[model samples]
Target: MSIEVNNESGYAVDEAEFAALARHVLDAMHVHPQTDLAIMLVGTDVMSELHVQWMDEPGPTDVLSFPMDELRPGRPGDVTPAGLLGDVVLCPEVAARQARDAGHSTAEELLLLTTHGILHLLGYDHAEPEEEKEMFALQRQLLLTFLATR
Candidate 1:
């Protein structure tokens, strides 16, 4: 898998570490070995614009996912899978602020956002309470497992 991370926000972040987190998220979801992902650590300005334009919210979000593949048309066993996932835009600045509020390091917060975004690429959604529970539980488990090995 190719996990490309671009730090375009001019923030002091460790690209290699974030890349590892991204890879771990993809692996946790059983994405194809050849799957490619591009991650951008953007500033609040960019994130705010995206939030307003795409989601109709007016604040910077920690992360946003844009999946390239469409949902399978039928039952899982009856349809072919599309191997291409899409891009994830992460705001490290927003993540850092959230981290401060959540009482964790920025790295930990980024890992959470990474897993959440990758899960979205894998057709996971958190629009409801049960869905949020399942998605967040998996994300937390995977992130904890990844951190445990490091």
Candidate 2:
């Protein structure tokens, strides 16, 4: 698997840890070894621009996922072909604020968001109540397990 992280947000963050987290998430999800993923950290201004351009939202959000090839997890007996998993853009400044509210470290918040983005890339969504429950539950489980083995 290819997991690349680029931090241009001007905020110092643990880029290696996120790369490891992405690897862990992809390993758990059983993504193909040839799969590729990009995690970019941008400032709030760029994130806001992306939010408006892609999502038509107002301001910068926590995280956004852009999927390529729409690669879903393969069935138990099927093999998943190699493909680009797309990019997950994040804003560390926004995450820090959310971290304060959630009473966790910034790294922890980023980990949660990273998992959330990976799920989205894997074709998981939370547009409905049931979907929200399922997506959030899986996100929580993945984060907990990943952190435990740290």
Candidate 3:
């Protein structure tokens, strides 16, 4: 997979760990090895612009996903096609604040956001209560599995 993590946020985020997480998640999800993905870490200013432009929201959020080819996970035994998975934009500044609120480290907060972003890229959403449960459960499971190997 062509998973690339770019830390343009100017923070000293661990890029390699994120790349590895992406690889692990995509692989477990059965995404093709030729698939392309980009993870972008940006400051609050850039994230706020994206939030307004894409979501019409007021300020920077934790994460945002912009899917390219609209790739979806294939059924078991089915061959997943290869394509561009798209971008997951993250804000470490917001994550740090959320971390404080959650009583966790900034790194853990970012991992959760990144996992959430990946699920969104794979056509997951939490607009409804049921959807929220399923999406969040899957996100938590994926994160736990990824962390276990670290």
Candidate 4:
């Protein structure tokens, strides 16, 4: 997988960790080895613009996903085809505030957001109750398993 992380948020973050976490998630989901992904960390202003432009939301959100290939998770014996997975845009400022409310570090919140965004790229959504439950459960499971390796 080719995972690129671009930090334009002007905030100090572990870019390598983001790439590693993305790799872990993609590998666990059995995505093809040649798959490509991009993670962008941007400021509130840019995030706000993107939020309104893409999601039609009013303010800066924590993370946003723009999927390119619309790939789904693959089974143990079947890996996803090689393609551009998507771009996951993150706002550190928003994540920090949410982290304070959630009583965790900004890094942890970002990691969770990264996982959530990747799930969205993998065609998982939470617009409905059951979808939310399934998506959140898988998100928790993937995050916990990744954390265990640290």
Query: Clashes in each model (backbone N, CA, C under 3 Å)?
Result: 0, 0, 0, 0
User: What value of lDDT does candidate 2 attain over all alpha carbons?
Assistant: 0.91
Q: Write the per-residue lDDT of candidate 3 for residues 16-74, one digit (tens) a residue.
A: 99999998888878888899999999999999999999999989999999999999876
Model 4 misplaced regions, further than 4 Å: none
Q: How close is candidate 3 to the true structure, as a TM-score?
A: 0.97
* Inter-residue clash pairs, candidate 2: none
* TM-score to native of every candidate shown: 0.88, 0.95, 0.97, 0.98
**Per-residue accuracy of model 4 over 80-142 as CA lDDT, tens digit each:** 999999999999999999999999999999999999999999999999999999999999998
For candidate 2, what is the TM-score? Answer: 0.95
Candidate 3 lDDT (Cα, 0 to 1): 0.92
Per-residue error for 140 in candidate 4, Å, reads 0.8
Q: How well is each residue in 14-41 modelled by candidate 2, as lDDT tens digits?
A: 8888998898878777778789999999
In terms of TM-score, the best-performing candidate is 4
Candidate 4 or 2, higher lDDT: 4
- Minimum summed lDDT over a 10-residue window in model 1 is located at 71-80
Cα error, candidate 1, residue 23 (Å): 1.9
